[model samples]
Target: MELISDDAPKSLELENISRRFGNTYAVRELSLSIAPGEVICLVGHSGCGKTSLLRIIAGIDTADRGVIRIRGEYVAGPSRFVEPEMRNIGFVFQDYALFPHLTVEQNVLFGLRNLPRQDARTKAMAMIARVGLTHLTSRHPHMLSGGEQQRVALARALAPGTDILLMDEPFSNLDRGLREQMRDDTLSLLRSMGTTVVMVTHDPEEALSAGDRVVLMRAGEIVQQGSGYELFHSPNSRYAADFFTAFNKVQGIYRNGQIHTPIGAFPSARQLREESQAVAYIRPSDITVTTAQSGLSGRIVQRVLLGEIEQLAVKLDGLEEPICVRSLDHRPPDTGEVGISIRSEAVLTFPNP
Candidate 1:
């Protein structure tokens, strides 16, 4: 891994990018700018165009309309298109696309065919060792574990010394425990190399934990984007709020710019018609269950222990469905009756549609 040049251009820039398939648009007038060495995670549901956007950036698919500039040079636009191989962009596919017959070193060396044989072999060995695979350099893909195969894919993609790399759900194939380890290890390696990365994933927690910036897309358009803290703490809409975590939506009425629900009155951030319907988004963790009668009266209908936290389904007096509350207290109240109080500051208010 080498330090990125200070004089290098912006890693990537997409202006009004769009792609269509028959009557449906996969990517719609999407625009984004990525800084050099930044790690960005593209997250959304199945048909949100996240993978489509990644393919366009890697030149695997052409944009129907827009301009793409990589490292300050035009790559794709209305009048020009660069071949995927000539774009100097590295891509790690979801399957860890390695040749079954090629050894670890040989797989990496394949990407450096443009260099002399000795030089390519030397650089390939260095990349293999950088990913901690020097001991398995002679092993083929079938002989390696999922994590090892992933490392080989990364080594091959990065051995070319390309500053920009695109990964599509690189860690999705591994099991839960191994997935976290591989994700952390992979990120550390990419950051050490000062590589500009655009990774696509459907997991919200992964997107929040892995990216320097998380781009949330919906229906082929960007719904919201910012740091993990920004998207989690200050979502702009109900859709954005629900994507990050589960929220207990409490319907309320808008009165004098405030949402008045059965539990409490919360400040509304969005302007709504007077007397129209409003909703409060509250996280299960944000609600506290107390034995004292200081808050709303609710009876615990069910309780389940989830390792570190205990989840309780509390049914309020008038609410149709029970609201869920998660607590980390070692001695959570027994399943029977409890008082529910929401953290006012953590409440997110939006208009009911």
Candidate 2:
């Protein structure tokens, strides 16, 4: 891939943007900035407005309020609006969206309409080669595998002189193996070309590993935006914590800046009023499992087989729900539980909801 221009600036800026339908807000007062050539991933569950925000940025959907700027130029707002086709933005859909009747080469050529026919063909074939699809350029979408069709879709999107690219769950449809391969390929390709990209995905792991920055959205609003490490380790809200990592919630009465639970006593923030109910969010990875039988007694009621880690459910003497622990310690499939140890630093305490 060749550079579009060293001086090209295609940074995106969204200022207090909002879009609503009837009483529901699809995108709330959201503001974000993306530097040129940065890849950002928007993540949340369904109805979180990630796709809505992506469409608004691509000019496929208009925001009801606030400004949308591309390279410091106002594209959508009260006074100005740019149509989708004129924005020089490329979009790759989750389904690949390749025309079944068109060959891979023709599908890529479709994006280079502004150029002469010969120029379009040259660029189209170049893009196909860039995506490693030169050998299958004549194949139709229906004849290609899931990953191949996706590459064709990607080539088509990038074939034009697009400044920014948007992808919505681009690899969600592929199997696990194919998804991982495509992810590495896509990121490598984008970095080589320095393409500015904003992708929306529901997969938390993908958002964590793929993007330069991850933006977590909830209820049409951005909950947090930062590096994956920042969001995972320093989440500001309980919702944010629960979204990024699975936690075993335990309820306790907060007093004197600490909460006692069935597992153990963990410190709470001073702001938590004494004697008030609090909940401790403990990550499964932090919980230690032992066969000592001397600590907090529990029995393994269920065991889940994950490739690298064993997820075990322990039923405490008095607690109703089993505490979950993910451990690398090898255990027999039918082994009984013994002891539980909770790591203090991994525990997050919040007011009971």
Candidate 3:
């Protein structure tokens, strides 16, 4: 792939954008800017407006309000709107969306039709080779594997030489291993081409690993946006923490910089008002099980052996909630009794209603 022009602007900016469907607000007052060659992943649960937001960005859906700028040029706003084709954005749909009757080469070349026939054919062949699908150029979509079909779809989207690529659930159809492989491969391709990409996914792991930054969305608004490490280590909201990973929320009261809960009184680093109700979040991995007598007393209710780690559900004394702990070693105590300690530094506190 050829290097993109440094002088060319590759930024995609959304300023106070909002979209609605009659009585329902699909996306409510959202704003974010993506830099040139940067990959941003939008993640949230279904009906959270992630797809609607993406469609608005792609110019497929008109926003009810706000401005969109591509490379510093205004595209959409209160008084103006740009057509989808005029925006020069490449889109990969969830279903591959490949033309069933067209050959792989023809499908890729379809986007380049505005160019000279010979030049369009040349670009299509180059994209096919770049995606490692040259061998299946004459094949139809039905003949290829899921991964191959996805690659063809990607090639078709990229064939237009658009600097911006938007992919919606691109890897959802693949198996676990294949999904990972495709994600890695797709990232490699995008980075190599210096393509500015915004992909929408509900998978936390995929969003964390694939994008330069992850934008966590909920209820038609952006709840958190940061690097994977930043968001994982210090999430701003309970929604972000729970969405990113499995966490146990223990409700308690905060007093004198300490949280008093059924498990035990523990010092909290999180800033909180005095005598405030709060929820302490502890990731399953942060809890440690020890054979020592002195620790939080609990009864092991269940043990599940995952390949890389074992998950134990322990019912702590005086606490109705079951605390979950994960460990690599399978030396779990008997189902009747277990002792576990919460790591002080790993705890996160959130305001309780």
Q: Give the best candidate by lDDT.
A: 1
What local lDDT does model 1 show for residue 164? 95
Which model is ahead, 2 or 3, in terms of lDDT? Answer: 3
The digit string of per-residue lDDT tens for model 3 on 1-353 reads 13345455558888898888888888999998788889999999998898898899889999999999987889999888999999999999999999999999999999999999999999999999999999999999999999999999999999998888999999999999999999999989899999999999999999988878889998899999888887888899888888889898899999888888877777787778989999888899999987548588787888998989999998987878788999887873568666788897789888896
Residue-level lDDT tens digits of model 2 in 1-353: 12235355548989999999999999999998887889899999999999999999989899999999888889999999999988888999999888889988889988888899999998998889999998998899989999999899999999996768999999999999999999999889988998999999999999999988999999999999888888887788898998999998998888877887765689865368778888988898988886656667888889988998889998988789988889899676775758877789768888887
Q: Candidate 2: lDDT of 232?
A: 87
- Candidate 2: regions farther than 4 A off: 1-10, 334-337
> TM-score: which is higher, 2 or 3?
3
What are the runs in model 1 whose C-alpha is more than 4 Å off? 1-9
Cα-based lDDT for every prediction: 0.91, 0.88, 0.89
lDDT of 1 at 236: 87
Q: Higher TM-score: candidate 1 or 3?
A: 1
- Give the winner by TM-score: 1
Listed per model in order, the count of residue pairs whose N, CA or C atoms clash below 3 Å is 0, 1, 0
TM-score of predicted structure 2: 0.93
All candidates: CA RMSD in angstroms? 3.0, 3.7, 3.3
Colliding pairs, model 2: 300-337
